[model samples]
Target: MTRIVLLGGGVGGSMVSNQLARQLKPEILRGEVEITVINESDTHVYQPYFLYMAFDQAVPADAKRPERAVLNNQIKLVVGHAERVDREAKDVVMGDGAHIPYDYLVIATGSRPAPETVPGLVEGGHIFYTEEGALKLRDALAEFTGGRVLVTVGVPHKCPVAPVEFTLMVRDWLDTHGFESSEVLYTYPIGRLHSLEPVAAWATEIFDQRRIDSRTFFNVETVDSEKKTVTTLEGDTVSYDLLVAIPPHLGQDIVKRSGLGDAGNWIATDRHSLLMQGTDNIYVLGDATNLPISKAGSTAHFQADVVSSNLVNRIHGGLGSVRYDGKVFCFIEAGNDEATYVKFDYQHPPKPQPPTEMIHLYKLAFNKMYWLSAAGIL
Candidate 1:
């Protein structure tokens, strides 16, 4: 029997496993193939919902579901932490010392925020990356009356547009709560409000209309919690009454420890084929790969389709012909009631669509569609 093991049951892993199960049903039923998924937690979170959850627009329960509830029954689910990959022996070592062997391996362990990398960042800043962090920020925002609200972007973070979304949402929240004295400010390492040229132009116009102060090229060096200040590497300092920071992100420790990661600690893979560099039977997807795309769930959704098709080809002794074109789409929220859509690929950069209430409705509808995706129905 051929054994296939998928690491990290995130969006990429779950989607690929679901597709493989359907495509290889005959082999699975005949007991000629086996599929197993290893994950650290039983819950799967719809991370996009975290933004709405922070502002009391969405319930925390709506953002997550049991992992097993979303995966296909034909696939095996192993709940454990992956320690390391023994590529030479073709085994995955678990934290509890179980060695799972595999004829083929899939790595989808996503990236995570590392706040500790910046001194005092954890203590000084409010973050909304995790469910807990979002809830905490919700409470903090609720108690805020009038002060300087600062949002900073740490380099190479997930959800490239999230910090901007949060700033706009928070600005609206302050206005609605009658905190007219509250000043909303934004800072980024890059020279523009957004990495995409067209989106940045649109965002800059919006920032100007909203009177939101923005400064670019501000690379964060450290945060002084006691003084309520953030210092850049160039020695520029900004003080804040309440700071919201997107912390530095890194790949899973196991990937780095196994020597499968690049110098930045992200897994190296062919941008087109999604195959891990220097390995034939191993593939990568999602935020784990060092691909030049936004580390958003939409990117993972598109990549999952490419990876699934390529994986099936390999299983049948055929070369993977599918090539991912770096396509990504995102719904950028301007405020509580309006949003804009942006779709692009590597060759074609993002062009902003006019912000509308309809797109906001679409974003809401996507939360419902997410479950269908998890169930492999869409």
Candidate 2:
């Protein structure tokens, strides 16, 4: 049997697992292939719902589901920590010392929030990347009456447009929930809303309208939790009653130790086929790749479609070089019951297209699609 082991059961991993289960026929699946996923968490998260944390739009109950429910039963589900991989030997090693052999490997390990890397962050403030973090932030948002609310962006983040959405959405929420007494501050190392110029320009206007104080090109250096102060590398300090932080993301140490990482320590995959540099049977997908696209769930869904087709082609020993356009079609919730949609790839991350109410509806609709999609019911 051709054993295929996938890692990290997040949005990217769950989507790919579901697609693989669907595309492989019964006959081929029985004798030719075996699929399994490795993950540390038992719950799958609808990360976009994290928007609710600041305004209480959604809760922990809204974003989580049993991880197994999001995957296909036909595939084995291994719940454990993946410590490393033996690419040449075709096996995965767990933290508990158990080794699972594989014919093909897909590294969808996803990303992790590293608050410790930022000085005084862990000791001073909280983050919202995980379930616990979200819950804590929810409480903090609800309890605080009003003060300077700083939502700082750490360098090298996932979903680059997220901070923009956070800025605008929080404005709408505070105004609705009577928390408009407080001001919001957005600080980032970069000078714009998005790296792409067109999108950045649009976001800049939004920030100004919301009355959000922003400092561009200001790299945050430390957080003095007791003083509720955020110190920038340039010696500027901003005080806050509640601080919402977006910390730098890093790959699982497994990739770095395996020597499969790139300059930023992300997995090095062939940009065209999504395969590892030195191995044909191994593949990497989602944010793990050093691909030039926003590390968004929609990006993973599109890449998974391409990777599944390309993997099947290679199984037949056909030299099919299926390339990804780095395509991404995601909804940007701009608040006021309005959202923007962008469909572009690495070649063009920004499409200065017009905005429409249709995008807002689609953003809401995506949540329903996601729950169904994750359950393999769509």
Candidate 3:
């Protein structure tokens, strides 16, 4: 029997397991293959919904579901933390001292915001990446009357356009709440509003129209909670009454501890094959990998298909022909009621698309489809 073990039961992990379960059904039913997924939490969170949850547009309860409920019954689920990967022995070291053996290993543990990299960031700024953070920010936003509102981005953050979306949403919220005196300012580490050229061009016009001050090349160095001040690496400083910061992101600690990560603590994999750089039996997906693409859920969704096909081919003693082309699709919210769509791949860059209420509706529909399909309820 082939023991296939998946680490991290997040979006990418769940999707890969679902596809693998279907592809290897014959072997699974005959007891020739066994699949197990290990995750730290018992609940699966719909992270994208957290944005709406912040504004009270979506309930918190609707954003989470039991992890087991979303997975196939045939796949074994283990609730534990992954300590390290023992590639030499083909085993996964669990936090509780158990070694889970595997013939094939899949690393899908995604990245998380690392606020520790910037001194005083966690103490001073409000971040909206998690449920608790978003909820806290919601209260902060409600209590805010009028002052400088700053939204700063840490480079290479997940969902590249999210900071821009948040800036737009906050502007609308201030306008609706009669806080016309409040000023909204945005800053990026790089020298552009967005990494994608076309999207940046579109965003420039939008920022101008909204009168949102955007400062580029302002890499954060430290934040002072006492004075509510942000200092950039080049010695530029900005003060704010309310600060929304996107902290630097890093991969799972286990990946780096296992010596499987690059200098930035991300798994180095072939951009096309999604296979670990130095190992044949190990594969990586989602934000954990050091791929030159946006670390969005859509990227993981597209990569899941490629990884699944490659795994099947390897299992059958054949080299996989399928390759990932760095495909990514994003829906950028203009405000509360309108959004824009951008699609691109390695061969092509994003082209500008006008924001529309219909695209916003499509985004709402996608949120529903994501939960339904992930739980196999649709």
Candidate 4:
């Protein structure tokens, strides 16, 4: 039997497993193939909803579901923390010292925010990347009266446009709540509003029209929570009443412990083949890969299609010819119940459309429909 193991059960992992289970159902039933998914959690979370949850627009129950319900029945679900990947042995070592052997392996372990990496950020800034952080930020916003709202962005973070979305949303929130005296200030690490040239131009135009203040080339060096000030590496200090930050992200610890990742714990992957560098039977996808693309859910969904198709073809004794083109799609909230979207690939640059209410509604609809996507139904 050919044992195919998925090291993570996020959207990419789940979609790939379900796709294989359906396409290779005959082989699976005949006991000629086995598929397994190993995840650290029993529940899967739709992380995009965390932004909405910060404003009480969504609840925890809306973003979470049983992981078992998200995967195909033919796929085995193993819920435990992985200790490391023994590539030479072709097996994954569990925290309890169990070995799960595999003939083929897919690594979809996602990235995580590391707020503790920044000096004083954990105590000074509000991060909405996780459930607890969102709730805490919500409470802080509730008590806020009128003051400067600072939105600082860190590099290599998931959801590149999220900080921009939050800044726009909070600008509207202050207006709606009658906090007219409040100020909204956004800072980026690069010399522009966003990494993408077109996006930065669009966002800069919007910021000017909205009277929102912005600063570029502001690399955070440290934060003084007691003084409510953030110092930058360029020798500047900025003060804020409420600080919202997008913290730097790192891949799972297991990837680093296994020596499969770089200094940041992200695996060096072949951008086209979606395979680990110098490996034939192993694949990496989503935020786990050190690809120079936006770490968005849509990227994972697209990569999952390529990985699953290639794996299926290989199982049938055919050369896996499928290649990923770095496709990524994202919705940008433009406040006032309006949104815009961007779709681009390796060969094309995204041209964002004008913000509209219809696109905003579509984003909300997709949030609820994310489960279906994870099940490989759409």
Encode model 2's per-residue lDDT on 1-378: one tens digit a residue: 777788878877787777777777673556788888898888888887876664677777878889988888777898988888887677998999899998878888877778989989987776767777777877876777877778888867777777777777777777877888779887778766567677877777777877877888777799998988989988898888888888888877888877779656788788778887777888888888877677888777777877777766766677748897878776777888888877787676565444567878877777868987765556
What's the TM for model 4? 0.99
- Top-TM-score structure, candidate number: 4
Q: What are the root-mean-square deviations of the candidates from the true structure over C-alphas? A: 1.1, 2.1, 1.3, 0.6
The regions of model 1 sitting more than 4 angstroms off are: none
Model 4 clashing-pair count: 0
Model 1 C-alpha lDDT per residue in residues 98-128, reported as the tens digit of each score: 9999988999999998889999999999889
TM-score of 3: 0.97
Give lDDT for model 2.
0.78
Judging by lDDT against the true structure, name the best candidate: 4
What TM-score number comes out for model 1?
A: 0.98
| lDDT (C-alpha, whole model) for all candidates | 0.88, 0.78, 0.88, 0.94
Task: State residue 104's C-alpha deviation in candidate 2, in Å.
Answer: 1.1
Q: What is the lDDT of residue 4 in candidate 3?
A: 86
Ranking by lDDT: 4, 1, 3, 2
**lDDT digits (tens) for residues 1-378 of candidate 3:** 998898988888888888888889898999988989999999998888878877777888878889999898888999999899999899999999999999889899999988889999999999999888999998998788789999888966898888888898888888888987789999888888888989888989998987788899989999999999999998998999999998889888998889999777899899998889977788899899999999998898888889878887777778976999999998898885899988999999998687899999999899888976664344
Flag clash pairs in model 4.
none
lDDT of 4: 0.94
